[model samples]
Target chain A: MTPTDLRAAFIADLTAVAPDLDPAAIGDNDHMQDDLGLDSMDFLNLVSALHKRFGLPIPEADYPRLATAALAVAYLDQALAE
Target chain B: MSIFTMPSLGADMEEGKLVEWLVKPGDDVKKGDIVAVVETQKGAIEIEIFEAGQIGALLAEPGQTLPVGAPLARLGVADEAEVTDPVAAPEPAIQASRAAALPAPAPAPAAKPVAAAAPGDAVLASPAARARAAELGIALEAVTGSGPGGAVLLSDIENHVSAGPQPAAQPVAEDRPKGKPGLDMTEMRRAIAAAMSRSKREIPHYYLMHEIDLQSAHDRLTALNADRTPDRRLLMGAFLLHATVKSLAKVPELNGRYDVEPYAPSGQVHCGMAVAMRGGGLIAPAILEAQSKDPDEIMAAMRDLVARTRSGRLRNSEITRGTITISALGENGVDALIGVIYPPQVALVGFGAPRVRPMVHDGTIQPRLAVTVSLAADHRVSDGRRGALFLTEIDRLLQEPAIP
Candidate 1:
C-alpha cells in the first residue's frame, strides 16, 4: 500500500476501536489525546498497534513525533514512502 | 436519554405495575435514590437507581414484565444530556402478563428486617425480585431464580413456601437473660456464609499456628479488666488480636500470599477472628489492617465485628479479604488445635484453652498457659517451613506483647 493508503488505513483502524467515533473529525491535525480520548493506557495501546501493523521501530524516546494524528500520519508517510 | 429501572414492589410480583416515575427521563439521580416501582406477587416495591448515569430511553413501559436484571430503562451516565429514546419499544401488557412466574415476595420484618442496606442484594436474582423480596418481608434464601442470569423470578416466589412472618430480629435483644441467651446466627451467620464463600473460593489459603504461655496473657487481661469498669475490661480475644498484629510485622511472609500463577501476588494480611455463634456454625469476622491497628483499635474493631456478627446485618464487604487469620478456640476451653486452613489465607493460628501444665521456662517448673497453636495451610501455595516460621513469629510476639 502507498504511504497515503497506510495512513488512511491507520485512521480507519482507530475509528473501528470505538465505532461510535466520527471519521471526518479525526483529521491529521487532530491530537490523538483530544480526538480519540486516548488516556495513557490507550496511548500506549495505540503505539503497540502502530508497531504491529507496520514494522516501524518508533522507540519510546522518539514518541514525541506522535504529537497529533497529522504528525503521526506524516511520520509514517515519510518512513513508508522511503 | 436512558430510562432508569423500576424496582419491584413486592416479592410475589412477576412485574411491578409501574406506580409512577419518581423522576422523568430528563431528571438527574444520585447513586441510591428511588426511581420507579414495580408490582410483584406480593405488593408494590420501590426500585433504586444503580448506575449514576442519565436515563437514556424507556424500554419497559408503565407496566412491563422486566425479567429481573433485564434493562427496564437505559442509563447514560457516561454521556450527559444525551437522552436517545428508541423509536420502537417492546410490548407491555402482553409481555408482562405472560411474564414468567417467580418466587413470592418477602419484605424484611421490623425486627430482623431485611438489612435496609443500600440495595446491592446477593447475586443470582433480578433487581425486581431482590426488591420484591426485600419488601414482602421474605429472605432471598427461599427464592429460586430462573432468569437467564439466574435471577430469582416471581414464579420462584409463588413456589416458595413462605417461612411466614419472621419474629422481629433486633441487634440488641431486650431483657437480656443473666447469661447471654445463646444468640442465634441470623445476621452474622449469613455474612459469614457470603464472605467466607467468596474468600475461600477465590483465595488459596495457608495456615500458621503458635503456642504461647497463656498464663501471661490471662494475667495481663485479668489485671487490665480488674482496673477498668466491667464493661470496658479487656477480653482474651482482644489480646490475641493485638499480639497477632505485632507478630505479623516480623514475618511479612505471613502478611500475604504466594500467588505462583503470576496473576496472584502478595496478599494483604487482614486478620480473621473465628467467632462461634451460640447456636451453630463458626464465623471468622475479620479485623481490617490488623497489623497496623493498635491494641485499642484492634479491640474496637473486634468488638464491632463480634457485635455485627451477632446482629447479622453485616455488609458482604466486611466479612472477607483477610490475608491471614488468628482463629482462637480458647473461649470454648479447647486445648491446642489445628484448624482447616481457610483458603487464600496462608495460615490460621488455632489457640486452644490454656491448660495448667508444668513448664520448664528458664529452668523452672512454673504453671504456664499451654495454649496450642495449629497451623493449617494449602501446600500448593506455601512451603511447610515458611508456614512454620510464621507461627514462630506469632509465638514470639505473643510471649512479648509490648504495649504500643
Candidate 2:
C-alpha cells in the first residue's frame, strides 16, 4: 500500500480500538500516546489490529519507531517493500 | 408453572428495576436463557433463567423496581413435542381473552392473584418483551403470549403492535422513578460505600505484598508475539491472570467464599477482575473458570469482559459467582494497591504498574521491569504465610515460558 493508504489504515485501526478518537483530526506526525491519548492497552490493541490487517508482525524492538503516524507509515512502507 | 423471581446478582444488591423483558407469553425457553435486563448499581445485567420450561405469563410490569426473589415471570413445563422440537403452536383461550379485552373498558384487577397465591405458578416472559412493551406503551396484561406455556415474548409485542395501539393505562414515566443518566455517581458511591464498609467491618483481613520480576515474562511475551500480528498478541495482564490462577491451585486455602458456617473453598478459579468505571465507582466481575483457560483465551475473555463492563452490559454470572478477586493498576497507575477483600470472597489480589527497578539478578545489579503483587486474605480462612506462598507461586510462574 502507498504511504497515504498506510496512514489511513492505521487511523482506521486506531479508531476501532478507541471509539472516541476522531480520524480526521489526527496529524501525520502526531505522537500516538502524547497526542492521541492512547494508553498502553489501547496502543497494544491498535498495533494488534494494524498487524492483523497488514499481515505484519510489529516487533517490540521497532515499537519506538512506530510511535507516530508518519514514522509508522515509513517503517511499514520499508517493511512491505522488502 | 413456576414463578421466576428477580435473582440476587450480588450480596450488595437488594433490588433491581426490571429494565426489559426478552420473551413474551407462550414462548419456549430453556435453562441458561437470558430472559431479562435488570438495572442495578453495577449496570444493566442480563439475567438468565435456571429452569428450562415454557413461559406462562409476565407478572412484573416493565419499569417495576422489585426486591430480590420477587416474581418477574412465570415458567411452566414445556410440552413433550415442544421440548424436543419447538414450533409455533396455537394460543390458549386465556391468552386470547386477555388480547380481546381492549383498553379494559374499566381498570382490571391484578392479573395473577391466583398464580401469586401459589409459589408454583410459572410465568414466561423474556426481558426484551417487557422492555419493548414499555417502550411501545402496551400493557403486558393485554398482550396474549404465544410462546410455549403461554409465555410473552418479543414477537407478542410485535403482534400487539400489528393489532394497533391500545389506550395505555399508566403514564410511561409515572410510578417509575424519573429516568436518570446511565451513570449516576451519587447512587454508585452509596453502593460502593455500603459494600466497602461491610467488607471492612465483617472480614478480618491480613495483607501481604511481594515484588515480582516481570523481565523474563516480558521478554517471553515479546518473543511469542514476534511472529504474530497485533491481533494475536497477548498482554502482560493475561500472563498475570494465568499465573494467579495457577498459584491458587498450589494454595487452595486462599480461594472461595467465607460467609457461611464453615468457609467454603471453590475448587475452580473464578477470578474477579476489579475494573474502575470511566464515569465513577468500581466493579469486580469474574471471568469464570480462569484456571481452565489458556493465556490467549484469558486475553480474549478479559478484553470482552472489560468492554462489556465499561459499556454497562455485564451478565449475572460475571457479577455474582466470583470466589477470588484481582485488581490491576496499569502503566499509568500506582506502584501498589492494598485492596479490601470483596465480602463473601476470602481473598483479593492486586497488581501495580510494571516499572524499572534496581534488581540483583545472579548476584549482580541490573534494571528490570518489576511489579508489586499484593494479597488481602480474610484472616478467618487464611494467614499471611499462605498468602506469601501464593505470591511466591505467582512470581515463579511468570519466570517459566510454559504456563498450563
Candidate 3:
C-alpha cells in the first residue's frame, strides 16, 4: 500500500479504539498514549487493529516504534515493504 | 408470575430512568436475557432479568424515573397461557393494565407539562441525553429534540455537537476542562462521592501493602504470549486477579459481604474487577465463580468486562454480585494505590504498576519487576494479621506464576 493509504489505515484503527477522536485534531508527532490518552488496553486494541488490517506480526518489543501516528505509519510501511 | 424490579445497579444508585424496552409484552425471555435498558448515574446499562418467563406487561414507561425495587415489568411463566384479565393477577397487574391503557392518551398531556416547564426546570430528555449534553458543555435548549414528544435524545446531542461549527481556537491542555470525553463526570463524581463517603463512615477499614516480585510472572506471561495473537494474549492484570482469587481460598474471611451484623462468608469467589471507564470514574463488576477460572479465563473475562463497562452494557448481576474487589492500575499508573472498600464487600485488593526495581534474589542484588499490592479490609470482619496473610499468599502465588 502507498504511504497515504497506510496513514489512513492507522488513523482508522486509532479512531476505532477512541471513537471520540477527530482525525484532524491529531498531529503527526503527538504520542498516541501520552497525548491521545489511549490506555494500555486501548493501545493493545490499536495494535490488534493494525495487525488485522496489515496482516503483520507486530512483536511487543516494537510497540515503542508505533508510539506516534507518523511513527506507526512509518513502521507499518517499512514492515509492509519488508 | 414474577415482577422484575428496577435493580440497584450500585450502592449509590437509588433510582434509574427507563431508557428503552428491548423486549415487548408476549416476548419470551429466559434468565440472563437483557430485557431493558436503564439510565443510571454510571451510564445507560442494559438491565437483565434473572427469571425465565414471558414478558406479561411493561409496567414502567420509557423515560420514566423509578426508584430501586419499583416494578418495571411483570413476567409470567413461559408455559402458562397469557392472562388477558388484569384482575386475575396481582396488584401490579392492575397497575400494568392502567399503564398499558394510558400510554396512547396519557403521554401527550403528561409530556406537555415537562416540556413546557421553565428552561432547565425539567428538560424533557433521557438521562443519557442529559449526560451527553453535560459532557459536551451544550445547553439542552440549544439542541433540537428528536425523541418522542420532541424530547432530546443522546443521538440528537451527538449530532448537534458534531454538526455544529468548530471552536474559533483549540483550547490548550491546561485550559481544557478536567473531565475526559464521553462520560458524565458530574454525575459520576456525585455517585462516587456518596459511595466513598458511606464506605468511610460505616466500614472501619484497615490498610495493608505488600511488594511482590513479578519477574517470574512477567516471564511466564511473555512466554505465554510469545506466539499468541493480541486477542488471546494475557495481561499482567489477569495474573494479579487470578492470584487474588486463589489467595482468597487461604483467607476466606476476606471473601464475603458484611451486609448484616454477622459477617457471612461466600462459598464461591465472585471477583470484582475495578475497570476504569474511557473518560473518568470506575466500576467494579464481578467475574462470577472466579475460583473456577484460570489466568487465561480471567484475562478474557476482564477484557469482556472492560469492553462492556466502557460501552455501558453491564448486567444487573455483574454489577451487584461481587464479593471481593480488585483494583489494578495498569502499566501507566503510579507505584501503588490504597483503595477504599466497596461497601458490603469486606476486602479490596489493589495492584499498582509493576516496575523493575532492585531486590535481593539468590543472595545477590538483582533487578526484578516488582509490584506493590495493597489491601483494604474491613476491621470489623478481619484484623491486620489476616490481611497481611492474604497479601503474603498473593505474593507466594505470583512467585511461581501459573502458566495455564
Candidate 4:
C-alpha cells in the first residue's frame, strides 16, 4: 500500500479502537490518553492492533511517540516509508 | 574465633529444642556437616558448623528449647590437637559453590526498614508465613515484621508482595477493575414494584396453609442421618431440603431461577436459602444440584454452608452467582409472607411458620401440623398460570407419601 493509504489505514484502526471520536476529528495532534480517554490497557491494545495491521515490531520505548494521533500517523508514515 | 549468631529461620523460631547431636565432644567437625539438629519453627533442621575445628564443648542440653546459636558446640584450633581434618579443603569451595548456586538476595541499596532486631524482638509468626516471605525473596530485615514483637502478619506480606519486581497482572487500572458502577434498579423495579404492588395490591392470594406431612420421607431420612457419626444430622431443614429437591424433580420448570440479564432461557435448578445471621442484614445462599443429593447429604452440605457463611468463610464464588434460592424464616414467626423476587434468580421459595392448623378432611375438621410455603416468581419469564402449576407441584412434593 502507498504511504498515505497506510497512514489512513492506521488512523482508521485508531478510530475503531476509540469509537467515541469521529473519524474526521482524529489526527497527529490528538493524544490517546488525555484527548481520546484511552487508558494504559487500551493504549497497549492499540499498539497490539497496530502491530497486527502493519506487521511491524513496536517497542515499549516507542509508546511516547504513539501517545498522540498525529505522532501515530507520522510514525506509521515513516515505517511505511521504509 | 567467630561470634556466630543463630541464623533467623522461620518467624516462629524464637527458641528451638535441641533434637539431636550429630557430633560428639572431641570429634573432628566439618563446616557443612550438621553439628546438631535444632527443632525450631515446629520442625527440625540440620545446623551446619561454620568452622573446621575440634568439637571441644557441648553447650546446649538435648530436648531443651534453646535460643538459636546459643553455642551448642565449640571447635578448638587445629594446633591444639593432632587434628587430621580432611573436610577443610572443600569448606571454602563449598561456601563459594553454595553462593554461586543460590541466587544472591541483595537487599535494595540504601534501603533498610530499621535497625536489626534483638533476640527478644525477633519474629515468632507461623512457619508458613516465614516460608512465604522467603519465597517472595524478600529481605527479612527490610520487611516491617508485624507479628508479635514486630513480627510480620500474613496480610503484611500480601500487601507488600507487589512492591518489588512484579512479573504480571499489576492492576493496570484499565484492565482488571476492582469494581464497576452499581446496578440501578429504578426502571426494572418500577415495573416489578408495579406488578408486585398489583399482585399483593390487587390479586387476592387466597390463604392456604399446609402442614409438613412427613410420614414416608421420615423413615428413609432417619435411616440416612443414623450411622457411625461424621457429625452431621438431618433436621427439619434437611427434611425441607429433601422436600424441595423432590418438588424440583416433580416440577422441572419450577427449578428455573430468574435470569433476564442475558435475556436467554435459564436452565438451572439452584435452590436459595435465607440465613438469618446475628447481624441485621439478610442474604440467601443458593444450593446447586439439590435434587441429586439425599436428605442426609443435603443436610450435611447445608450445615457446612451455614457454618461457612456465619464464620465469614464463604467464598465470593459461592453466593455471588447462583441459579435459584430457598429463603426461609421458619423460626422467625413468618407464616409464608410475600417474598420479593431477587433479580436474575427466577424464583425465591420462602418457608415459614411450620405449625399445626385445623383442616377439613372429608368433612371432618382435624388439626394437622402445617407449614407455609411462599414462592416469588419472575413475571417476565412466567405468568400466574405457570406459577400456580409450579406451586401445585411444590405442594404435592411436600404432602406426598412417597418419593422414589
Candidate 5:
C-alpha cells in the first residue's frame, strides 16, 4: 500500500477512538498521545485497529515507532515491505 | 412469577425509556443476563436480570418511558415440570407467540415453535451472548456453554469468535446505537443538576486539600511502563486510585453510603471513578471490590469502565453500587477541582493534574512532581479531622508507591 493509504488508515483508526479529533488538522509529526491527547486506552485502541487493519505484529518494544503519524506510517510501510 | 422492574441506575435517575428488549418470551435467562436496554438520563444502559428464569412476558413495550421500579418484564420459574403443567403453561405460551409475532422483535424466533418449546429446549444463554452471536453471525448452538448448568455466556461466544477465522474488520460500533448522537447530553445535564442540587441541599459537605509529592509515584510508573505495552501500561490515575482505596481503609467512616438517617459504613470499597463521556457528560461508575485489586487491576478496570461508560453499555450494578467517588482532572485540566459528592455516597476524592514545582524536600528546595489531592466529605458522617487523616494517608501511600 502507498504511504497515503497508510496515513488514511491511521487517521481513520485515530478518529474512531477519539471521535472529537480533527483529522485534517493532524500534523505528520504530532505525537498521538501527548499532542493529540489520546489516553493510554485510546492509544491502545488505535494500535489494535492498525493491527486489525494491516494484520501486522506490533510488538510492545516497537510501540515507540508508532508515536507520531509520520513515524507510524513509515513503520507500517517498512513492516508491510518486509 | 417475578417482576423484573426498571432499576434505579443512579441516585439522579428517576425514570428511563425502555429502548429495546434483547430477550423474548420463552427465552431462558439467568441472573446477570442483560435482558433490556433502558435509556436513562445517563444514556442507554443494558439492564440485567437478578434471577434465573424463563422470560414469561414483556410487561413494557419498547419506547415506553417508565419510572424506576415499574415492571419491565415478568419472569416465570425455569422448572420444566412447572412449565409443563396446564395452569402455568398456557399463559406464557400465548405470550411467547405474541412476542414472537411482534414486528422487528430481536432474537426473532419462529412464533409457533418457540412457544411450543417454551422453557425446555430453548437455548440457555445470556441476552448479551445472544446479541453478540447475532452480531458476529455465530450460531449459539455451535458455541459451547461455560456458565452454570451449561449456559452459553458472553465470554464463551467471545472465545468462539477469537478461536475461529477472523471476521471482516467491522467495528463493534453496531453493537451500540451510534445514531443516538452523543447520549442525550440534555438529560445527562438534568441528572447532574438534580443530584448535585440534592447533594448540596442534604449533605453538609466539608472540603480539604493536600499537596502530595508525586515524584516517587511518577518515577515508579515510568519504570513500570518502560517495558510494558500500551495495553499493559499503568497510568498515574491508577496510582491515585490505589492510594485512595488504601486510605479509605484507614478512615473507614468515609468509605460508605448515607442513604437513610443513620450512616452505614461498608467493609468493602467500591471506588467510583468519575469519567467524562466523549460528547459531554460525566458518569462515575464504581470499580467493584477495588480493595482486593492492585494498581494494575485497577487500571484495567478503569479502562474497561471508561470504555463501557462512553459506549453507554454499563450494567445496573456499576451505576448503583458506588460507595465513594474519585474525580481526577485530565492532563490539561486545572490544578484542582472541588467535586460535588454523588449522594447516598458520603465522600468524594479529587486528584488534580501533576506538575513540577519547587518544594522543600529533605533540607533544600528542589523541583518535585506534585499533585493536589482534595476531599469533599459529608459533615454528618465524619468531621474535618477524619477527612484530613484520609488525605494524609493517601499522601503517604503515594510517596511509598506499592510494588504492584
Candidate 6:
C-alpha cells in the first residue's frame, strides 16, 4: 500500500480508538496527545490498535516515532519494508 | 416466583432506560448472567440476574426508563418438578400462565420519613449506624437519631461526619474546569457534586501521604516489557492494583463498606480503579479479586474495563461491590491527590505522576524515579498510623514485584 493509504488507515484506526476525535479535522502533523487530546490510557489503546491491525508487536521504544499521523505513517512504512 | 427488579448501579444513578433484553420468556438464566442492558447517566450497563430461574415474562418494554427497584421481569423456579399427569398438568400450567400473564403493579409507597430525633444518651440507633459512626471516627453522642423510635439512622452518621468541610463546596465549584460545549455534562456534574459533597459532609476523613521510590519497580517493568509487544506489555496500573490488594490483606480494615452495619472483612478484594470518560465524568469499576491475579492479568482486566466503560458498556458488579478504590493521575498530571472517600467505602488510595527526583540512600544523593502516594481514609474505621502502615506495605511489596 502507498504511504497515503497507510496514513488514512492509521487515522481510521485512531478514530476507532478515540471516537471523540473528528477525522476530518485531524492534521497529518497533529500529535495524538497534545493536539488530539488522547490521554495516556487512550494513547496506550491506540498502540494496541496498531498492533492488532498490523499483526506485529510494536516495541515500546518505537512509541516516540509514532507520535503524529505523518510520523506514524513513516514508522509503519519503514517497519513494513523491513 | 421472583420479581427481578432493576439493581442499583451506583450511589448517583437514580434510574436507567432499558435499551434491550438479552433474554426472552422461557429462557433459563443462571445467576451472574447478563439478562439485559440498561442505559443510565453513566452509560449502558449490562444488568445481571442474581437468582437462577426461568424467565416467565418480561414486564418492562424496551426503551422504557425505570426507577431503581422497579421490577423488570417475573422468574419461575428453575428446578420445579414436572407434573406427570397430562390432564392435571395442563390445568395447573394454564393457571400458572394466567398468574404470570398479569402486568407488574407499581411498588407500594415507602413509609413516611420520620424527622430526626433529639440528641441524647437515650438515642436509639441501628447496628449500621453504630458501625458507620465507629468507621467515621465520630462520637454518636452528638448525632441526632432519625430512624423510627428515635433511633439514629445511617444518614445521620454521615450528616455528622465533619463540622466545617461542608463550606468548601462553593469554592470548589468555582474552581472546577468548565465543561466543553455540546457534550451534556450537567447531569454528570450534578451527580459528582452530590456524591463528593456528601462524602465531605459525612465522612471524617484523615489524610496520609508517603513518597515511594519506584526506581526498582520501574526498572523491573521496563525489563519485563523490553522483549514484549505493546499489546502484551503491562501498564504500571497493574502493579499498583496488585500491591494495593496485597497491602489490604495486611490491613483488613481498609477493605469493605460502612453502611447499615459493619461487614466482616471482605473475602476477596475488589479494587476499583477510577477511569476518566472521554466527554466528561469518571467511573471507578473494580478488577474483581485482584489479589488472585498477577500483574499481567491485572493489566488485561484494566484495559478491558476501561475500553468497555468508555464504549458505554459495563456489568452490574463492576459498578458496585468495590472494597477499595485507586485513583492514578498517570505520568503527566498532578503531583498528588487527596481524593474524597467514595461513600460506603472506608478508604481511597491515590497515585500521582511518577517522576525522577533526587533521593538520599546510604548517605549518598542520587536521582531516582519516584511517585507520591496518598491515602484518604475514614478516620472512624482506621487511624493515620494504620493508613501509614498500609502505604508502607505497598512500597515494600512493589520493590520485590513478587505475586505469590
DockQ for all models: 0.00, 0.40, 0.24, 0.00, 0.18, 0.51
Cα-based lDDT at residue B97, candidate 4: 42
User: What docking grade applies to model 6?
Assistant: medium
Q: What TM-score does each of the candidates earn?
A: 0.47, 0.74, 0.79, 0.39, 0.74, 0.78
Residues B1-404, model 6: lDDT tens digits: 55677777878776677777777656678999999988655567788999897775566666667766555765655665211111111123333444465443233223233222211223468878877765554435446567896687898877766453222111112243433322236656777787788889889999999999988888888888887877788877778778988899889998988765654667788888998765668888888888888788888899888877666477889878888899998877678988988888889999998889999966899899888999999988899889999999999998885632
Screening candidate 6 with a backbone cut-off below 3 angstroms (N, C-alpha, C), the clashing residue pairs are B124-B151, B128-B260, B128-B261, B135-B380, B135-B381, B136-B380, B137-B380
Model 2 C-alpha lDDT per residue in residues B1-404, reported as the tens digit of each score:
45678888777777788877777666678988998898777767899888887775566666667776665765765542211112112234334455554332223223332312233223356678877765664445556689886788999989888977443222333343221234446656778898889999998999999999899898888788776666777888889999999889889988888767877798988999987654447888899999889999998888888767655478898888899999988766679999998888999999998998999998999999999999999998898888899999999999987852
What is the overall TM-score of model 3 with all chains considered together?
A: 0.79
Candidate 3 lDDT over B249-290, as tens digits, reads: 998999988877688889999899887765667878899999
Regarding TM-score, does 2 or 4 come out ahead? 2
Chain A TM-score (model 6): 0.94
- B1-404 in candidate 4: lDDT tens per residue? 22223443332234455655656545666665567665432124456665676664344445555554343443553444322222122234323444555453233223233221211223454455566665654434334556787676666667667575322112212232111111112322333354345445433333322344443354554455454222433455667766766665544554553333444433555566665432223445556666677766776677656644433233322443455567665433646765765445556566775666776655888765566676666655555666666566666765555542
Off by over 4 Å in 6: B81-184, B401-404
Tens-digit lDDT string for candidate 1 (B219-326): 766566455432344556667667766766655565554434542433355787776543346656467667667666776777666655543233222343566667
Model 5 over residues B2-109: C-alpha lDDT tens digits? 556778887777677887788876677889898988877776888888889777556666666776655566566555322222222224443455555665333423
Local accuracy by lDDT, each model: 0.55, 0.76, 0.77, 0.52, 0.77, 0.75
Off by over 4 Å in 5: A20-40, A47-82, B77-182
Q: Write the per-residue lDDT of candidate 5 for residues A1-82, one digit (tens) a residue.
A: 8999999999998887776677898999998767886665677778777878888767656878999999999999999999
- Between candidates 2 and 5, the one scoring higher on lDDT is 5
Q: Report model 1's chain A TM-score.
A: 0.75
CAPRI verdict on model 4? incorrect
